[model samples]
Target: MAEPKNEEFLDDIEDAEAQAYAEEMEEIDDEALELDQLRAERDQLRDRFMRALADAENARKRSDRDRREAENYGGSKLSRDMLPVYDNMKRAIETITDEQKEANSALIEGIELTMRELLSVFKKHGIEIIAPEVGDRFDPQHHQAMFEAPVPGTKAGDIIQVAAEGFMLHDRLLRPAQVGVSSTPAS
Candidate 1:
């Protein structure tokens, strides 16, 4: 009878200990789950922060590029407006009669001086002229051919005459050179 009582007490103690251990394991598992949730939230927040930072950087770069372009092309309209005056000055110098030039050296000199001053003004404002002389090869990038003339002593596709001079403002083409090209003579 005494041995039976001792066995029952031992069985009860073992059951109580097993229950306590199971409760402790459950608490530990709950803590681990909480920790995992916190880590996942932290990772998501970090990714969002990185994306926002990248967007800000991209916007800053875009703004800087826009500012630079504005600075580069600020005077485009003014330069374009002044092109006709320059062209007229160039025409005046080119169309003078040789006899008039000889008879009135002072008038010719004054015209030449005015043309030079106009060219200087163009250089100051970032406007440049494109005029290819005769015998120069015709380039489609800067020259537009009005017609092809059959001539001798010149290669085909060579520039024979410049009908209208071209102009540019800060590496941008304002006008295309109207030119006459040469073709092979008829055999």
Candidate 2:
């Protein structure tokens, strides 16, 4: 009877140990699940932070582009309004005769000086003159055809004459050069 009772006592001890091991394994499994959840949350937060940072950088770039464009093209309207004054001054200087210059030398000198000053201001402000001469290849991008005429010794699309000079403000064309295009057939 003593031997049988000792065996039963050993069996109880084994059951208790097995139960303890199973509980410990369950606890480890729960901890591992919680760790996986934490890692997933951290990854999500990192992704969101990276996206917000990219959006901020894009907004900054757009603002810089807007500022640059405003600085370059803000005064375009005023610059265009002043073009006629330059044109008139240029025409007056070109049409002046030698006799007129001799009779009014001081006045002519003043006019010439004023025209030069205007041209200097235009140059300083990124305004450029587009003067197209005759017999050059006609480019529609820079020249506006005022009239088309066929003339001897000229190919089709050849420039027959220049009616008026053009102006450019920076990379933009303020006015196209008025020109006459030849309608002669390409031979």
Candidate 3:
């Protein structure tokens, strides 16, 4: 009976040790799972942060391009509106007769001064005049042909008449010069 009791006690201790080892292994597995979850969360957050940073940089570049375009072309409409005033003044100057100029010398001088001031302002604002002569070759990019006529002693595509002068605003054509082209046949 004493020997049987000793064997039972040893069996109970072995069972307890096996149970403790199983619990320790379970705890280690739980810790490993928790660490894996933390790593996955950190990777997701890093990816999102990198994408947001790229989007912000693209927006800044787009806005800078818009600002530059606005600065360069802000006064385009106002400059275009001022063209007819220049044409009318030029016509007035052209129609003045010699007798009229002699009689109204002071008035003519005032008009001339005003015209000069207007041209000076145009030059300051990057406006240029496209003055094509009657005998020069016609250019379709700068001249708009109003009519085609076979004028004597003129070659084909020659500029016969210039009805209205052209204007340019900083390398862009505001108005093309209205002209008449010669359609002469070759001799």
Residue 173 miss distance in model 1 (angstroms): 1.9
lDDT per residue for candidate 1 within 1-187, as digits (tens), equals 9998899999989999999999999999999999999999999999999999999999999999899767766777877787788778778888889898999999899989888887898788677889889989999888999999888888899999989888877788878788999998666
Q: How well does candidate 1 score on lDDT at residue 134? A: 90
lDDT of 2 by residue, 68-138 (tens): 87877778898889888988888899999999999999999999999989889889888899998888889
Q: Model 1 reaches what TM-score against the true structure?
A: 0.73
Assess candidate 3 and give its lDDT: 0.90
In candidate 1, which residue pairs get closer than 3 Å at backbone N, Cα or C atoms, i.e. clash?
Answer: none
Q: Any idea what lDDT model 2 has? A: 0.90
Stretches of model 1 off by over 4 angstroms after superposition: 1-20, 96-118
Ordered by TM-score, highest first, the candidates read: 2, 1, 3
What lDDT does each candidate get?
Answer: 0.87, 0.90, 0.90
Residue-by-residue lDDT tens digits, candidate 3, 25-102 = 899889899889999999999999999999999999999988975665566688779888989999999999999999
Candidate 1, residue 16: Cα displacement in angstroms equals: 5.3
